[model samples]
Target: MSRLTAIIAAVVACLIFCLGWLAMHYHNAASKQQTRAESAEQQVNAAEAVTSNVLTTMTIFNTISEANQHAKEQIALDASGASADIKVAVASDDCALRSVPDGAVKRLQQYADGLRQGAGGSATGKPDS
Candidate 1:
């Protein structure tokens, strides 16, 4: 009877130890899962913010493009000798100009260069009369 009692005690101890180990393991796994979920949420939020910013920038760019086109048209019309000074004044206003597209400023500079050359040629008596 004494031996039997000792064996039973050992079995109960082993069972208790296993239960405690399982509880600890479960707690650790739950903590890791929670951390991963929070990390993923943060990433998603960052991505959304980036997307929203890009969209806003694109909208602003589009608005600028449209305004630039309108201004250019007005300039062209004024170049035809209709209220030239007014058109030039409007175009000269910084706020009236659109945010030039990437590389567009270079193209504009090129056009300006051409105009300068033409003006110089005309002034030098090389007009294509």
Candidate 2:
């Protein structure tokens, strides 16, 4: 009877050890999965921020293009009957001190000339004359 009781005790100990090992493996797998999910979320956030910045820059560029077109139309109308020298001097802005502003002024002048030369004020860089 004592030998039978010892055999039963040994079987119970083996089952308890197996259960503990299985629990540890399950915990490790769950931790790895959580880390991967967090990394993916961070990448998605970074992509969204970049897209938002690009959109803002494009909006500002479009606004500048429209303003340039409007300036060209008004200058041409004001200088329609004036001499060539007077037309060249029109739309001269005092705040233009940089190279970029110089380029903008040059672009406006070309547009104004196109409008007066019977091309109808277009700034699409196509030859109107």
Candidate 3:
């Protein structure tokens, strides 16, 4: 071959090799970016699932707390009504009033007060807003 043609042919081969190398580099970079995007998407999905589970757990706790408060209110009411009935019955019987000590009644009242406080209710046995 002539000298000029040989030089031109060598330049063309070099150009083809450089283009192949560039294409391979670009493909590798794109694959790495796709992998990163997939990992980020998985992390986001996991976060969403955790948030939903926490919300559900909080809802259940609230439901249980409200039920407990309602039961406490009912118990307080029943206790007070029974106290009034007992007082009336005891007042009518002199012997029974002498048998029931005053300390026992005070202890019972203290127990009811603790129940109201624990149930988030007022001293009047009403649930707090």
Query: Which candidate leads the pack in TM-score?
Result: 3
Question: 7-54 in candidate 2: lDDT tens per residue?
Answer: 988998888999988999998999999999999999999999999999
Q: Name the lDDT value of residue 106 in candidate 1.
A: 74
| Tens-place lDDT digits, model 3, residues 1-129 | 699999999999999999999999999999999999999999999999999999999999999999999999998999899999998888878687565579777766766787757744444556446
Question: What are the C-alpha RMSDs, in order, of all predicted structures?
Answer: 13.3, 13.2, 8.8
Ranking by lDDT: 3, 1, 2
Residue 48's lDDT in candidate 2: 93
For residue 4, model 3's alpha carbon misses the true position, in angstroms, by: 2.5
- Choose the strongest candidate by lDDT: 3
Question: In model 2, which residue pairs have backbone atoms overlapping below 3 Å?
Answer: none
Q: Against the true structure, candidate 3 has what lDDT? A: 0.87
Instruction: Estimate every model's Cα lDDT from 0 to 1.
Output: 0.84, 0.80, 0.87
Q: Which pairs clash inside model 1? A: none
TM per prediction: 0.59, 0.55, 0.66
